[model samples]
Target: MTNEELEFNNDEEVLTLYDNEGNEVLYRKLLQFYHPEFKKEYLILAEESNFSDEDGDIELIPMISTDDEEGQLLPVETDEEWDMIEEIVNTQMDEPEE
Candidate 1:
């Protein structure tokens, strides 16, 4: 869905994706940014139901992006990709939100 078509609930954008078992799962799009090194766009998504960690803090999981036509969110593979994702995310977290 396009960004404009994204539905927001409680001030968060929600996207519905089906799991391996074909069950619908809801996730909140916490962040989206282009990875300069990888020349690809990535997203930080947290499952709605599992939004919080055991400590009741927001858990950001999965730095996902795929080149496939479907635009499916696939987990990034490789140390380099992971490192880049972490670095970008950390930088984002440190920046004061406007």
Candidate 2:
């Protein structure tokens, strides 16, 4: 991907992703950042709904870069990748909101 494409400076709040059965799922964008270690841009998102876990926690989805346009969302493929992404999420959760 080009440097410009990697910017991911999108302003859209909701993103629609299709499931394997061709169902559409809407997600709210939480954050997006470039991973220098993996040389990839990652998009972190949460489902756009009032639903939560039994403990009232919203699940975060981590998406990796794709060869095509930015609308496409690809999941993290490896254990190492998941670890890195999880670390980022943990750090974000540990931060104090202003």
Candidate 3:
């Protein structure tokens, strides 16, 4: 994989992740917020068309970036953290853009 494919940029608004088996997956940025308790940055992403689920609902995946060349993606490890992130993303997504 090239360097470009391995990295994610907020300016680009889209992210591509490679699986362990070397398959390329894509996701679009839906929301980004900072966790007040953990003091970490997080992103909520909608899986791209090719990776979407059977019901056509855009699956949201929450991740934290390691900020390296590989752009390592890590999930919110704890239930509390996941709940907090989920609520924040949902609330933000429901608001209208001004």
Candidate 4:
């Protein structure tokens, strides 16, 4: 991967992760997954609460995608399955109103 390909920038609230091939594997899926030990660390940082200002680089373990190797796409035949996934994604994207 080149310098630009491995670069991860978080200008806004969105976090974009790119693969070696310059394909976006994951995007804006809550930075909480970056470190499992500390829950809602990103939220705390965003709120500027009692959060550590230390900018530590977190490395993610490589995940083997079955579809990537086999070139197989997810079977989304029925509308129900699509709706279910859509609902789940929507729920994740929703922010709690204060």
Give the alpha carbon lDDT tens digit for every residue of 1-96 in model 4: 122322222333433445569975533223221222211112101222212246643232212112255522223345654454344334434546
lDDT of 3 by residue, 19-85 (tens): 7899988888876655545766677787686445777666788888666797677887999888876
TM-score quality measure for candidate 3: 0.73
Determine which window of 10 residues in candidate 3 has minimal summed lDDT.
1-10
TM-score attained by model 1: 0.73
Report the lDDT of model 3 for residue 33.
59
- Candidate 3, position 2, lDDT: 27
Query: For each candidate, C-alpha RMSD in Å?
Result: 6.9, 5.2, 8.8, 16.3
Count clashes in each candidate, considering only residues at least 3 apart in sequence or on different chains.
0, 0, 0, 0
lDDT score for residue 44 of model 4: 9
Candidate lDDT values, in order: 0.71, 0.73, 0.67, 0.31
Inter-residue clash pairs, candidate 3: none
Model 1 residue 86 CA deviation (Å) reads 1.0
Candidate 1 vs candidate 3: the lDDT winner is: 1
lDDT of 2 by residue, 21-80 (tens): 999888877767787668887888887774355787888888885667655667789998
Q: For model 1, what is the error of residue 82's alpha carbon versus the real structure, in angstroms, after optimal superposition?
A: 0.7
Which consecutive 10 residues in model 4 have the weakest lDDT in total?
A: 38-47
